[model samples]
Target: MKLVTYLLLGVKKIGVIHNSGNVIDITDIVNTDDMNVLIEQYAAVEHLLKKICVDSDARGLPLADVHLMAPIPAIRRNIFCVGKNYYAHAQEFGNSGFDSSAAAGNVPAYPIIFSKPSTSVCGPGATVDSTLDPCNTIDYEAELAVVLGKKGRVSDSDDPMTYVFGYTLVNDLTSRQLQKRHSQWLLGKGIDGFCPMGPVLVTADEFGVPANQKIRCTVNGEPRQEAAISDLIFDIPTLIKTIGQNITLLPGDIIATGTPAGVGLGFTPPRYLAIGDKVTVSMAEIGELTNTII
Candidate 1:
């Protein structure tokens, strides 16, 4: 099922995209306006929600009539991110002189992790601001994000898919200058409107194992990044087990599995984003997320 959070008639509601491509508003049956609440109660209510979708009398609106929002419009905590998980991306980043490790031509034995504050979360088609002081060098990272279904520390022996509820696309926007100057990624990657996610969240069963999916990003209709998820060095299972060892993965928590090669910084002189530039990140089975620089 493709789940979504949308705005209709000025009220934000939770919905599911029906087989016909229309949206079935399930808020009334779900008895809440919060997607988090729905997610928390998903297992218990999954059947009922599915029934609502097939009911002949159920009312549904054309997808074009509603405005889409991030699957989890407001997260309970920071977004977990994996960096340099892709071999080629790691090499490119290291060679670009921006990597703190400066380990050019070497892939890490483990996943490089980071976090993006909840404030950075935005939805598809949102405008990303680029006028902040010293933030002139903005870049994009197209990634496939995993949404946790329950809270737990996944062990290496455990099935990581058991904890995953769904998958979505995320554009991990960054300020290259701030990244290098601050010597950390927080200020550079956690800026407001930096994480543009969603169109819909495809459940685990629907998306299957994310590895081997095609991930790509385009700026103003020009392709910039492309790679297969199979290129990930650590993969999803390793990332969950590694991070879960310390932090508890909660329902609604997002884990962005990092980007591929061909980022702006990988170019000869580099090509940063400017105002009015449009970026679209696409992952097969999930969908595409597009945003414009303001």
Candidate 2:
């Protein structure tokens, strides 16, 4: 089922997108005002949510009528991100001359991890602010993000999929200038509205294994990034194992699996995002996330 958090008549509600393309408000059935609360109780409520999705009498609102919010607009902590997980992207980034470390080589034996503050999260169709200082060069990275369902430390013997809750798309927006100046990623990647996510969150069962899915990004309807999830140098299981070894994975924790090669900075003269530019990040089965620069 495709789950969503949306606003209708100025009231935010939890909904499930039916196969009929209508959004069924499960707020009454779930009895919760917060999506995070519902997600935390997902295992207990999955059956009921599925039943509501098929109930003909269940009231539903046209998808176009409601404003969709990020699956989890305000997360409890920073968003875990993998940098240069795609081999091609690593080569491009290494050659970009922005990172002294990237100059060493394209592929790293270990995952290059970073975090984006929770404040950066924004929903599809939202407008991103681009007028801030130190953000003259904005870029987009389309990625397939995983949402955790249970609290556990991933072990070599454990099946990582068992810990997954769902999948969503994330446009890992970046400020190249800040990234270079600071010599770190926080200020460059954690700007408010930098992470535009969601249209729907597909449950793990429906999303299946996190491999070989088409991930792409477009700017103003022009294709910029395109690659398969199979290209990930450090796959989901490895990421979970690596992160879980240090920090416990909790329900609703998001891990962006990194982006493919066509980021604006990869170009010779860099095609950075500008005011009025629209970026659309799409992952097969998970749906698309589009945001515009204001």
Candidate 3:
């Protein structure tokens, strides 16, 4: 089932997505605070969903009735992101004549992990301030985001799937100018409203086949990037397994799988985002995630 974090009547609440485009409030069913506690202990979010499913109130509103927030709104900790996990994206940034000075290199044998400030996460329809900082090069990356259900340390024997809650779409907004200047990603990617996610977070069981999902990204109604999740070099399992071996993966923790090629920077003149540009990232089982650049 799909889960959503929403604000209705000025109160934030949680709910399960209904087939009729409505949202069933599972807030009363699951112990949300307890779920947060479990998350702190690196426990799964699915357990909470299961509880909600078993004991839900009849009170539900149409998805159109509430204001949606990030599926895991107000996560106790920051979200994690994987960078250049796609060979094509790594090649585009390192070899695509956009940054002619850099040399194309071999894909890193290990996952390149990073962090996007939790504050940057916004929900669908949220306005992303492309010009928020003084950076001139605003870029967009479409990635499949994985939400962790529990925490685990990085180790060889770790099973990343056991910690997974579900998946969602993420727009890895970037300030290319800043990125090049510092050679670090934090400032370039951690700006408020940079990581726009969710209309809702679909549970893993509801996500259909993990390897066959279709992922595509479009800007202003035109397709820019398209590929299957199958193309990922550091697939979800590897990512979780690798990352978990080193750090504790907690519930509500997000991991944005790297994007495919065809980003604005990969264009002839290096097309950067402008005021009012719209970016839409979609997947087959997961819902669409759209945001406007301001």
Candidate 3, residues 1-294: lDDT per residue as tens digits? 777888889887777776555677766655562334434442345566555554545456877789988777666667788777677888878764333222325576777777888788898989987667696788999998888876557566656687777888889998888767666678888889998988778877778667888789899999999988898988898988877776777777788988898898888788998999999999878778889988
Local error of candidate 2 at 148, Å? 0.3
Q: Write candidate 2's Cα lDDT for 156-223 as tens digits.
A: 78887777888999999999988888888888899988999897899988887678688989999999
- Each candidate structure's TM-score, on Cα atoms with residue i matched to residue i, is 0.96, 0.96, 0.89
Clashing pairs in 2: none
Query: What stretches of model 1 exceed 4 Å from their correct place?
Result: 56-59, 102-105
Off by over 4 Å in 2: 102-104
Candidate 2 has its poorest 10 consecutive residues by lDDT at 99-108
Which candidate ranks first by TM-score, i.e. highest? 2
Per model, how many backbone clashes are there? 0, 0, 9
lDDT of each: 0.87, 0.87, 0.77
Error of 1 at 244 (Å): 0.4
State the lDDT of candidate 1 residue by residue for 1-294, as single tens digits. Answer: 889999988899999888777899888878987877888889988988777767777768998899999989898999999888888899899888888643435788777788999999999989988875265899999999989899888776788778888899999999988888877788889999899989898888778767758999999999999999888888888888888877888998899999999999999899999899999998768788999998
For candidate 1, the TM-score is 0.96
Identify the superior model by TM-score, candidate 2 or candidate 3: 2
Summing lDDT over every window of 10 consecutive residues in candidate 1, give the lowest-scoring window: 100-109
